[model samples]
Target: MLNGLGVWDIFLTLTTLTRGYLIWKVVNLLTRSTTGSTNVYQEICGQWVQTNTLTMDNADWGTFVRYAHRVKSIVIHNDSLFGNCKTIDVSILRALSMPPIPPASILFPQLRQLVCYDRRDEIYPFVRLLFGPKLTKVDVRLEASRSAQLAVLPSLAAWCPSVKKAELRVWRERPLGAGGINEVRALSDVVCKWRHLEQLSCGVGCLDDKAILHLGKLNSLRSLQLRISSHLTYHSVRQAEHGPLFQFLDHIHMVAIDSLSSCTSFFPLFSSLPPNITISPYAPYRSEGLCDLFTDLSVHESSGVLEDVSVEDHFQSTAPEEVFTIETLRPLLGLHRLRILSLETFYSFSLDDNALKEIGSAFPLLAELSLTADRGSNRHSKISVNGLITLLGLCPHLTSLSLTIDATRVDDIEPERRPGGGISNLNIDTLRLNDSKINHPRIVAAILFDVLPYVDVFAWEWGAHFDESDAEIYRPRWVEVQALLGAFRTVQEWRQPGFLPM
Candidate 1:
């Protein structure tokens, strides 16, 4: 067992063991030095700390004062921990009451962005400190309180003079012209005084004639977002005529605005302005000429002011054929500058070739498109994937597409089950299809072969009967589908490492 003598062999074995221990000690010392140079917790903790954001509900007055001194921005949202009240009790009030904290500058010298819930009018004086020359943005939500000091507008404007940009949602509209004139005058003064004011967004609880008149006086404003109910009448239109409201607008975002009856109502005033206008599909006003009153504005046809448009329509107790027709989408197709288009709550009158063609050609610059059909109580006609492929042919530049089809009908006791045949023609990189009733390997294979011949990635939701384990058995079918398109031979090209089993 030894090279020459047993004692020599034992000495050699002991020498090797001692060398191994020395190597282990050197590795441990090297690891310690590396760790000392980099501490992961410091990076993580530093990321969590912000210059000036506080959970006022969870923080005390002393804590707020300490952080408020460095805070340049503050955002306070309704939190369950804070008792979920619309209004938060600012620690600033408590701090102000305490042993005359050195001047407010000592407590909050750089705080600028203040976002608060509409608590009451009495909080105005306390808020004034945060709205000095340093303030740039203010977001406040208003609630109805009859006895609050801020029950009127003049008091609010007078309390805060340095608000440059403001977003307010009030419980009721301020009276304009004669009755709300004093409040309007105060607002006018505030607007005039804030030379740097650029954006004003207001959601009125009640938009009356006087309110529109008061809003017309904001000539210096560059961007305006208004949300008012459909109750605004022709009388209110008369009030908007006294002063030009849309003259200086370069950008406009409108929501829940049902009162604007037609382009004639507001566009005539802004004849000289070339503004990028956007209207949320939830707006109440239904366009009289918008293809059978579907309540959508066609950006292609409209002076290109509304560049991107999304349509959401709901039909009441009517058949899909009766609700949506080729004529219904005429206004949408007319939109010119539409680069992104999404149609939700789509009710097709019929899945005819003409209907598909009209929709496909509606948006030329569209790179992303989503069409969602509603699954209502009434039965809906099934749409073939081939029809979608045909649509893709019309939209040549499309890179991403989403289609949600619901073919379930109430009358049928048993639905006919058929394989999903592949779609041919057209080139698209990304596709999402939601089908609940489809699941034949041959059917899926045939469909994928026809559509995604060169597709690198494929994402599909399994039909109702499939689960995780079934994917292994059905995976061969997927391979078959790709094989038909010559994709199987190039297996290395496809990389979907973790697919949810069929």
Candidate 2:
């Protein structure tokens, strides 16, 4: 028996020693590979090349150029690198320069996309270099001087015949005289020539009904986004108005309209939109107009085909305003096929238990729902624990949810009747509580866990005015709730083999 025990001890010692040696060798090998100039090329060869300026000496420049073909993307702020290489094979390039490199020096044979934000004087030369057949995408934002010449869109079309996507923004350095309707006509003429272009975004301060009609002729266009000056008007409701622009929207799958004016009218045009389409409007409209817009959408036959709806007040403001009321949203409930709904407001929006119930009952197919207040805004949302429970019970198909509710009065309210009883199975994968004002986060977390025990991702943040010093008072309660949730998950996994807990 003593000899048998000695043999087992020897086996254990040998196994441990072998493992230690292997671990030591691995550590040494990793250390050597990561800690020297010899590995620099290996470290950066496959990565995106980012440089402030090309100030490296000849040796370093040569080394970078030798490995330039391995770079998939590069961003250069200065133009000094233009002369260092005869050829580069980057796929994407972004150059921010005051003066563009000479056209002759630009040599990116394999480039597919290019983004250049430079002065008007440099844009021509920079664009001339990117006029190859392989270039499919281009984004150019030019700063125009007082004497700056307008870039001819025809020239761009002639050079970039195979370009599929383009975004152009021209801003004058100083407030100059506005371009006339003639300029708009000229631009439309140039843009209509791109037969291969599938997507186009332009902010040229001269797009109107005529330009839109001209662009409608492009049979290959799948997506269109236009940023036009607010001064341009389209009176689609007028009896005398008849344009091909409305017909153009019928074939396009996605359209985004951005107007610089605080209030731009598109009601007349939107009424005739395609039944199956995605529309994003970045400009804010008047509250009354917005209500009218929703009412119109609800009654339209195309409302059933609407898949994504987002209303965000992009301007930063502190006080919540009454932008969207429960009554205004009541009409939107008719959109039964809606899958994604996002409404972020700067002002306090009224959302009661009844409204939540109506939403869940109306949009049974909703996969993502985000009802959040703008960041830094003070919100007084009227959502109780019972209301949230009702919503979860009704929306069984929901996978992602974001809610900003004022739960300060949760303790005062009675516990929900049949709390989490209706939910037989939970499909929720992500939940985010924005600026939770709940008296106890643990209680809220527990309530959520009871309904969505399998939720893979959970995030919560306190209200803007929450005091951190008082966290100690709530630490024990949070730990208790977490322990209960953990045990619940463990039991669930044990009962159902192969169950993954989050």
Candidate 3:
């Protein structure tokens, strides 16, 4: 009787172990089928799934579909998948033709943000598949083609009523034809339906007088970006009897304009904008328009509070001549609180010693400054090494500096002496220099090391000086400079152990 009882206990223990192994095998199979090869998705069966954001390009659709249920945010560029595909595969066509899953049973049920870039025809179907009640942010860029029609933004807005931020870009290779005005009017009518939208950016030719009025009705809107096209003429925007543009400008802190047609119409409205607001234009103003803008800004009381400004010219194949002079920029002296200034031109926006001196005197609190030219031209030859050193001395608080260095005449002129004594240590964190005519790298490196010892990043654009093979030749110079900088830092730290380097 004792032997029989012992045998029965061993049999029960074997059965329990067999059942546990079978359960483990089943779980592994399920995980492999559900999450594919990515280990991050293995534990995505519960609350952990909702924390993930997925970005999918044309080749990532299979992965996207496999884990769509777990993703919370999705950024997809579907242009390559459908835009030029003249013939769709029969299998894919059949899959797309099938009715969308019920809202209750849909994939990406927790998706809150959707960013899509595709042609108009492809964008609609892709958006339809991923639409969810919880989606609150949508950014769509529709590549403009002559065959493509304007996307009805209001209809898109209707699909996602909860969207608080919406950015729609419809860029065309060519200017819109005769019906562009009517298309813009339709867009104006549709945007008013987005009562919950707090931020909206619709690219050029979308903002007309009537549209601005409709946008004004969106009391929830706190930020807006509109491209200044021909539709926004000086007379139309300024002569408005009772439009909300002025009232809307009063509430927003940031305004960005793209492809500005002229500075005359835009600058006059500067007084209406709130004192704290910053204006950033995507394209450069023409030479004449920039002069007018500076002239107007010189006397404006609110210009003092304008802290950030970016000016770039329209990119062209042939380089343009100097667009601005020191005399033209003298008007900007009124901007006392300016901290950030960027002036980028195609090839020839000349800055001389006197101009650098004027800029240094004008904005004493400048922390970030950039004066970049795409290709070095004859106009850039006027900027010498002395001017740059003087400019650096004036703006002691500068943290980032990008300048075009024309070191052709450095040997002829002596380095400017700092008024107090030797070179004062610059707090510059990043230094970008372009077209250094100086052939010797050590001399260039030594000059920079003396003034900006604490610089963390050094970007030298050796345009014609060095080719791919010559990269090895320059490596020693860079290494030497870095070693010197490291030694300087070590000594400084030893001298003042408690002091923090910015």
Candidate 4:
């Protein structure tokens, strides 16, 4: 038997090569035979981490380089790396830069898209390793100061010059003092180089007055979504002298706007915006502010060409002064091409029977109308059940409807006699009613049975909408209404010409 230094020599020589060969074989099987397909999309998570440069330091990287060649997308989504967290998707990229990999031996040479997420903003510094000339899309979310998030932009433009789509969100922004302004400047500079950037989503803080002005001039930008901050109000934008703003824009979104002032400040800047627009604000808006917003739209070149315009989240405020009156929404009535109009708020609209009739006549082609108010929002005179029926009859094209109706006086309001049921909302498929103050259940159900006889789905807010007392009293009435609808529907089916007893 061999002894002494011969045994130790074998251990030193064989053990090093054995460890490297074992790691290499495991990685090969994962990307090759294990999946039973060679074309599988690879991710940098557990098992994947073992092939990272740190694990294979000074060993062998031929197997890794072979696998990394086919990777077109790289995703780093890890929650907390400090614990023994099972999801290790966030670790590989951060460790890919050390040792044996070498500085210039680029991995992921064919990478085109990079999606990375970190709660602490640590993974992105190593994200550059995944960037290549062919990269077209980058979506990153990190938690850090505004300046730190802006720093990633410079690297993106440096590596992925022709990126067509970019979504960058920076959460938990700390106080930046004067440094914040410089970060905005940096964002403007970096994006100006993104000659092919067609769609962009970022925080409003990243696009100040000057930055937005430059962005509008980008001919390639078609869709833009700005996540607005309540604290930031854009008031300094002006018409660019060299060219028209957002000339070729097809879609525009202004989301998370906490104030009406924010909407007015930004919407008026563009000479003409996209026909289909989405403005979702988290806070309540006064009637006057909304009126001003629509008035601004009325003058824009896009208003005449507009079809669907939805201002979400901002609803009728509980305060009497904040309610949307017919006059407040008068500007929208002129948009003849408008098909879908949604203005659901927390409270109630001040529009009455006359207003609904006018709206129906104005937009006769309307298909979807959502004017639903929150529960217990009876501060104003709501449209009666008959008023809703008239509006539905006028707009035969209506398919989906969500609104608040007063069915309290369903019996006395209309005593007209009918045959089997009320006029059928034939084309209507979806219906949502914010039931309030309904003393008579049978009459209301009978009336609804006549109107909406063939609804595909009926949306009703139950326990979530009421207090214990409200639920106990009002729930049974609504339940009775639903049961009556079913009974009435059964009779209608029997009345059909080809009905069989079975």
Candidate 5:
């Protein structure tokens, strides 16, 4: 047929077909590009992206918008304006105001995960519409004049039925008028609604006695962590027994307990509950009483199901009892399920060879261990590194270990030297430390290269509080760390993971 047609006509027809194919390919490319300012669609299926017009360039927003309809997750990062605004920018303010969620039929209908870091007042309402029945996870970091936490209760109370994990941060709240009552009211109401909630972290400004009592209503809660500047009491935890608080609870954490002695009768409150509990010794005056509490609770023997324990207070105690060590921990060895252990601030306890062997017999199932020292000048007592290494020999099941080493042999006293070398036959896989005090280059080198060959993850960070010049002068320690880790099975600089510089 082509032979019958003229040569010029045939060539022109072939060129037109080729051009059409090329245009189709370009359209396909454009459709595939999901990140930009403008949303894109192909027939019925499409995606959308929301971009801050003020912050993101036109091209960037275009890229995001192109895929906006398909984007099930969104993240916004911006600081607060006044540090006191109560309102937040609703997540879908722009999208819902404009196109809104498309009317389509699918098994999972709404967006899955929404993360907002904006301080604008519109965030709360935005989250309400975007996270419908289908939302599973919501993380919002907001700064408001009235406190972002005020916005959290309503959003979580309504949507948490579908959410498995939720995190909220608020700046500050002034407890006054009906507004003060509002937070407590909201928390009480929402705890009942969020039946499926598993993990939660929120900063509640003034969680008074009444509000704390209301917290026990979350019966289905498994892992609950609260960071508050408010007062807490035994009745708060006591209310959990008959109410919604401890029905399915296996893990409970309360951090920054500015005053434990203020709640003196609190720890004994959980005696009737199950054995699994974690109490951070962050409150003042936990010295001997704190350790005694752990022993008493763990003495249930058969019911001693307490597997996780963390005591972060390491300051020199006013009490006269010996500092905690593997020897002291020997009594609780009868608590068979004790596995995860963490002790911070007090790192200078002596663990003799016999104690190490006893520890091996005690915590056979132990998996994660973290021992950290306080960086303050209060570390008047010296830590025995050799003894600690010898103690590690007993923990055959140990997998994760994090130690904050003051690396210096002695501070105020004449330079009393510590053991020079590291272990050779330990089964640890991950090791992390902040060893700014140690000036010896080979200290870490000895650990990484000669010892702990089985270790996989090694990390160390210079002290953030050190003077700039000190940090620079100490920068060589980091290099030494790299060199030491390099000689081992693997090597990488330690970047604080999920840790905000305090």
Candidate 6:
């Protein structure tokens, strides 16, 4: 209970940057520890979910007011907390229309960061109260109508003067042209006030030719995410006045760009690239479009420094894009520093042993590679078990691997029997095989043990997309391979006393 909160604990909470939090999460959005549930959705975090609403009686409020000066961060959910709040102190309801609410009355006066969800009109009063003078960061998700959303933008700018990092997620507030132009202009006005903003996320509508040049001038911006409007086209960003656009950026994520041309044009507007990039389009592009996009990406000055690239879609479209063909992907061959390359689509790669070796040799430091495609045949790729051996030999640092391999024949010159002998990759811990043909389970299992002795995540198709015939043919064999891997793990653990568990 809040009754036990003391000035000493408050001191520690502010000094150590830990204890001052509402609900469960602290300052970090996703900590990725045992308490984090973001990476694995099924992970249960019941203990952390103590209460969404911070309740207080008259005595509790009195005690809370004592240590309020030390509270540094707060996270709130609008579903039941701030929007429908009924138990908060009445001092919050009185919104004084001044720049900084006098220190004598500011609620959580020392609060520096706020993460809140907005759904209704009830959040407006709490925003006035919660937006402390020292707030430097704000992450808001607004799911209200367009009119209601526009009404709150001006208030945020007037209140949160010190905010350096902001994320505004507008969810279905209004249609693109349905009286949204004015709201978009208001957002741009609010954004211009944040001159020192190191990170920002909002709709692409806030960035026009002028705003792009303005944002480019701020060298502190390192990360950016823009949710493209459905009405966006290549022409929308064509008029961007070409200056230093996001040259200091280290990470960028472009989400919901549906068309092929729109995504391509978006890249060239920024001549420099962030080391980490993610392009998530609602629809898949054709092979030529992918080639063109890569061409645009390759012309940049920092292309060699690019470390991670993920081009993914929710579902495989019946587009004409050729999957991972050597000819089509030649533009990306110069990204020698690439460590993570994940291309997820429900199609096969046009990869043979030679293409595979060439690609692997190009990215020598690749640590995690995922080309996990769910398709019917291995005809597009001729990389049998031996080919995998060659690929693994090339990529010595690959730890997590997902590929569509032709595992039909299990013939490999045993590492002991090769000309100079072969060395199996011991770095791989997660192995996910695409829907490739597997005729021999025992041999394949042994081959896998030889290739990736430490593979803990053995992934095969377990989705509802399979037909009865396909399931009957492939499921049991892979299941046997899994069983064998378990037995092999048991035997290996007995031999090597310090290996990580599978």
Relative to the true structure, candidate 5 reaches a TM of: 0.60
lDDT of 1 by residue, 21-106 (tens): 11100000111123356322110000111223222332344444543443466554443324533233344334333423434453
What would the per-residue lDDT of candidate 3 be over residues 1-502, giving only the tens digit for each residue?
1223232343343223222111110011112222345432221111111122222233334433443554566554442555532322223323342433333455566677877654546345545666666778878776444223355454555566787887766666653332265556555665665677778777543556656655655557667766554435646546666534443443332222434434335555543443333333444455665666666655654565566666654444443344455665677777877787776556445667788888888888988887765554333446666677778888887888877555544574345743224455468856665433444555555566667777743434443322434345444555565566676677768789577656
Q: Alpha carbon lDDT of residue 71, candidate 4?
A: 61
- State the lDDT of candidate 6 residue by residue for 180-281, as single tens digits: 566556666677667778888874334444455566667888888775533544363456445667788888877654665565666766768789987766
Root-mean-square deviation per candidate: 16.0, 13.5, 11.4, 8.7, 12.4, 7.8
lDDT per residue as tens, model 2, 271-374: 34443333333444455655665676667645665766666544434433444567767778888888777765544456777778899998888888887654
Task: Answer with 4 or 5, whichever has the higher TM-score.
Answer: 4
- Worst 10 contiguous positions by lDDT, candidate 4: 21-30
Alpha-carbon TM-score of each model against the true structure? 0.57, 0.64, 0.68, 0.74, 0.60, 0.76
List lDDT for all candidates, in order: 0.45, 0.51, 0.54, 0.64, 0.48, 0.64
Arrange candidates by TM-score, descending.
6, 4, 3, 2, 5, 1
Clashes of each: 12, 2, 1, 3, 45, 1
Report lDDT (Cα) of residue 376, candidate 4: 50
Predicted candidate 5 versus true structure: per-residue lDDT over 1-502, tens digit per residue = 2223333343343233222211110111123322334434332211222233222234433433333344355454443433422222243344332333332432124356766666555555544545556667767754435445455667656654687776654444431212245554554465545556767655433344544454455554567655333244445456544533354567666554454443234444343344455555443543455555556655533346578776665223443323445545655667666787776543334434455456556777877766544332113223334434555655657777765444554223222432223335456756665443456666645544444666643333523232455555655775676566665433322343654433
Scored by lDDT, model 5 comes in at 0.48
Off by over 4 Å in 6: 1-64, 78-104, 173-179, 203-206, 228-243, 315-324, 374-379, 412-420, 461-468, 496-502
Candidate 2, superposed: residue stretches over 4 Å from native = 1-110, 117-124, 144-154, 169-190, 203-206, 228-230, 235-286, 299-301, 318-320, 375-379, 408-418, 422-425, 456-502
